[model samples]
Target: MNPLHRNKFVAAIVAVISLTACSTPDAAGEPASTTRRVTNAEHELVFHVLEGKSPALVLDAGGGLSSSYWKDLAPRLAKATGSKVITYDRAGEGESDEVSGPWRVENAVSDLEAGLRELGVTDDVVLVSHSIAGEVATTFVNEHPGRVSGAVLVDANVPDFFTDEMLTAFAPVVEKQKADLLAQPSTKKNRQLLAVMADYAPVHRVFHRRAWPKDVPVTAIVASQTPFTDSPEAAGLWRAAQERFAQARPNRKHVLAENTSHEGIVTERPDVVTGAVEDILKIVR
Candidate 1:
């Protein structure tokens, strides 16, 4: 794909793949919190913790983003909700150890489980996941339904959205990007990006077959413009997916972040995101 085509395709699926580094400020903007490097199986993951009380709130960034995306919002959330806020860099992102392989939700979950155990935050977790981290939150909740009390999915990519047709729509761009990345010299960022794109379709295919545990309460926040400003059909499918997720069970609510785009929800619409988390905290408490 040429530069122009790639840009358009990327904008269409911005929520699923983030090739460039997040536009959020660097670690210098991170809140005054306890930061530590947690190791698992010879790999090191950097986690930032803001002390508070349970249930602990774990913030997982979207694809291609580091914990820095939460810098401005973490401290505010910690203060407003009085719940422990935890954020970390996934393997190959930020200061975490880089491993050679495709990015899988299961591995992400393992890293999370390790971090939570190391920090002694084993229960009452309120997972706050954005964009593709939604998959991590979904798998984690299902795998450990007993631990998570509530969840907030912000402009996330829910399983219901990745239908056969949608996956087909995503293939051309994903394949072109993967091929392009494969031809380049392997840097940490390129490797991570390629690995993630390599399995993007397959992961979503699996995600589409899975469902969120009905017992857990959830809040699905949908962005106004979504991630498909260039494709109306895809945008419609995205909104419908969130609606299905919200209405599938009791204690699930769907909120529309009017005038917000997928990427802007975390930066420009922290109030909406924060409010949703506060509401979930109330129910879980």
Candidate 2:
């Protein structure tokens, strides 16, 4: 794949893989966040942490993307919400330790927990997750409910993504993404992250469902387009699930990122997402 095509193709599959698996404006003319690296034992995770007064806002990337995925939005979100916006690359994805392990949602969750601790961020945080990271954020909320004050699921993967029907539906998308990705040699290491995600996805579905946190406020934001819910039946099922998730606990809300694509919800619709984040914080606070 040409560099241009590789970039384009990378964008395309980022949307497809999350179901197979599921930003901001800034001011001051510079990024508000400061970059630093933290160690979770052998792995060195690079983070961009914005210092502010409000509860922390942690950004989780979709599979195959680095923390750079939030480059356009985090600083703006930090300014908008008057909160710290923390973004980092996962193991083997960017500067983070290429720690070898299955991409179990639990491991992702653990990494965040450890990383947060290393940052001395004991205060509860609002997890902002895009794409399949819905699984990771959702699992973290489950394992450490007290640590998460809220969550924003931006076109995020549902907890039950691996239902028999969904997996059957999701396989083709995943396979095609895998094939396209294989042609991009520069991305081979990134695919290692994908490999673990694939191995643990079904297990994550089961784990998240049985223990999804119900105490904190959650906002489910859906992009208008998603590989997981493209057709009539799939769309209906997706909407119903998103709604039910919102209704699952008190103070949950669902919004559509009108005219937004899966990636755009994070990269382009920072204003919309930040609005949702502001609203969620207002209610929870």
Instruction: List model 1 lDDT by residue over 1-285, tens digit each.
Output: 345544565545643655112223335534346777788767888888887788999999887789998989998898898888999998888888887777788888999899888888999999999888898999998888699999999888788988887667657777876777779997876777777776677777898898898888999999898787766666677888899999999889999988898877888889999999999998989
**TM-score list, all predictions:** 0.89, 0.80
Q: lDDT: which candidate is best?
A: 1
Q: For model 2, state the Cα shift of residue 75 in Å.
A: 1.6
Q: Which lDDT values do the candidates have, in the order given?
A: 0.82, 0.70
How many clashing pairs per prediction, in order? 0, 8
Candidate 2 yields a Cα-based lDDT of 0.70
- Which residue pairs collide in model 1, if any? none
lDDT at 170 for candidate 2?
49
